[model samples]
Target: MLKLLYNKKASAALANLSVGGRLPHAILFEGPQGCGKKLAADIAAQYALCEGEQKPCGVCSQCVKVERHTHPDLRYFTVPAGKKEFPIDLVRQLRQEAYIAPNEGCCKVYVIDQAHAMNASAQNALLKIIEEPPAHARFILLCENRSMMLPTILSRVTAIELELPTVEQCAQALASLRPQNSPEERQAAASGAGGNIGRALSLLETGKPARAMADAKKLCELLIFADRYQPLEILAGYDKDREGLLAMLPLLKGMFAQIAVSHYAKTGRDERVCNRVTPAQALDAAQAVEAAVRQAGQNVNIPLLCALMVERAKQALH
Candidate 1:
């Protein structure tokens, strides 16, 4: 099952909560993109709406409906296509609908995808309902980074973080899911995506590395060379593409992490990033990239954010 394999910690926690009947009114599944936040949310929804005693028996009618996304009591929401932020109008509509009782089950589950993309206004609008949610209502928020969320919203939600699997694990999964592909192909895709299963599968399907990963790799090269002009030039390409910028952040973070690890481990390090910076500089740059990633979800101006990220990264290196 998607819940059991990739993230044991998250799986155990969600299972315990559902079995103990101690699920909170709101839950936030925070993780990098393609790290199974949506899958975890689906599992949580099943646990809440499942009619079986074991909670999400997977064979029960409610569980099947939830799996098929046919459960009336389970509602899914995301930023509308082509829209940059979660609009306030949608939040207002959802708030009005939240007052209604569940249609088929004892409780209602609302799965909000990209919760981090919610602007300050949308978050405030959502807080009103979450703060005093109806007895039968439940919320499961999916976010890439929790720092973009309002403190009040974060305070009310139970947060669950999911970790990426190893390249070997991801490759094994791909073998089962994409058996037509050779083992060599699977491993290559897995390594390219840094163990993100969703991204690896996408790589397999397209036979092309994602643009975000390419851009991130380029940025890593520029940072390693301590080039000033090229970093700004690359970042300017993302000024109008926040989603692309968001996708790139985790890749950048992962590369920096490798750089930091390489400094201490002295072997099995990425060739492109090895010996580029001092150990302290690599660690500091990793933190800098991480902070930039967290800040990306804050609805900040993309150009300004790119500038700040470049500045901090350079400062950490030099």
Candidate 2:
């Protein structure tokens, strides 16, 4: 029921439970950013709250209200902008609200985003309610790292971990989400994001991320084949664009990762994960990029660093 492009396992598991009318009262959706955990939580909440026979039939008023976030029965808790952690004060308030009767829907859905931001006391306050939640209440916790939660709290919920999609899968997802983008554009965004479709979407939706990714991809191709000066010329545009320069580093590292994966694939080891680049020198290139990222953080001279990075990459690739 989640409209996300990937993470089929989590989707299927949740769907099965909803259809069987056996969905858990408390759930945890955990993964790195852009892995679609939040969206999964939304869909699960809708499915659980829907009153229709088919359950979460999007046409039903209950489902529509949940989608629009106008449902009185569905509430959320997240850390405020300036707060360093999810405070116990708010958790206590949530606990008190949890027992109240739903105003409209068959059940009440409670969504907690960035659940990892809850400190020890805050999670403890939350554990009390989830340990013995009201029969009409469902809790969904969205977390960046599952380990951040207290063991006791984690045990009380059904946890689902989301995985990153492959580049081709990401490209297809992006194609569906952004029909205006060319396949090549979607593929570039997918590659630049390290196969995170959410990140790819952000790259396409925001011109800055897309521009930085374009520069990184161009520099990657030039590093592999261009003359030394040509590559240096490419780096010059990033002279004052610190954000762009930083964004390019991960992508440059990813290109080396692709080469390493491609090498294993050629040996028939990891055929499921494919990459276009083949290199006898992937390790060297990867190390050079790592060093550049490290040095960039230490206030090095910009122009000197840029030229040196190009030279190091050129030598490593050659």
Candidate 3:
């Protein structure tokens, strides 16, 4: 069984198949970063390789092997670190290996991370095996978004979308994962990460992301309630911190996005910003933040970039 606190829809869909004992030959788990796609893929692989009567009884040897990544029949693949995309050569090799018999069991489970990073050629090569997979083979693809996948590949697999949990749920989850941390610390991390478990964990491990998010939220509040000069004070703080600026820009953009749609939807902590800023102004601010992110990546002068971002955000209010 898949043990997950959030993404109930995805868990249920995969759980239903575990009961039939005939899982999909190819399945894709799609969600944003920190949304538990990898965890779901591992659970699905366990379900395929388990020998227990109830399917993926997690205490069984087969399940333990999968957890330890020592199972001979379970294969894992991902793009080489520092590389932009999966090479066609690796995909061809994977396709060839899909036909080989399982080493330790009747079923072979292959879990591929960052499947969306495969280029057209690599995706086409992968399409061959998924199109006509061996009877004993099962493939699990993990990606942030399904839109990056080729249409042909998308048609061949079952795609499950994993949703992020709410802030309270994320805080509750952190209690179990990081028992040493105080409840207040966990709640702060969860709020800073906007309910992303992976991001919250990263924030807890290193205070940088949490610091960036805190500054970003303060800037948003200033932009909404105070004069333009007050926000510049916050922006100038990031002038010498490139990494912090890079981290904070996306969060600022995301907050603006939430503000833009808050009139029609629920946006949790951004309700104050939504009430103060109109949807049009919020959207323009989001675009300005996006431009600042691009400029930061291009080696722009950090101080000049920060000043320009503040100016643009001020203009967005008009």
Q: Clashes in model 1: which pairs?
A: none
Summarize candidate 3's per-residue lDDT along 233-289 as a digit string, tens digits. 877887776656766777788778878877787435455556578999999989998
Residue-by-residue lDDT tens digits, candidate 2, 83-196: 888888989999999999999887889999899999998999999999999999999999999999999998999998888887678878887788887665566577556678
RMSD to truth, every model: 9.9, 7.6, 8.7
Better of 2 and 3 by lDDT: 3
Ranked by TM-score, top first: 2, 3, 1
Give the residue spans of candidate 2 off by over 4 A: 209-227, 238-318
What TM value does model 1 have? 0.64
The candidate, 1 or 3, that scores higher on lDDT is 3
- Across residues 173-272, which tens digit of lDDT does each residue of candidate 1 receive? 8888889976656665676576788888887786433566678778988987957789889889878866556557767777787787776675687665
lDDT of 1 at 252: 78
* Residue range with the least summed lDDT across 10 consecutive positions in model 3: 266-275
In model 3, the runs with Cα more than 4 Å from the true position are 208-318
* Residue 76 in candidate 3, Cα distance off native in Å: 1.1
Model 3 RMSD, rounded to 1 decimal: 8.7
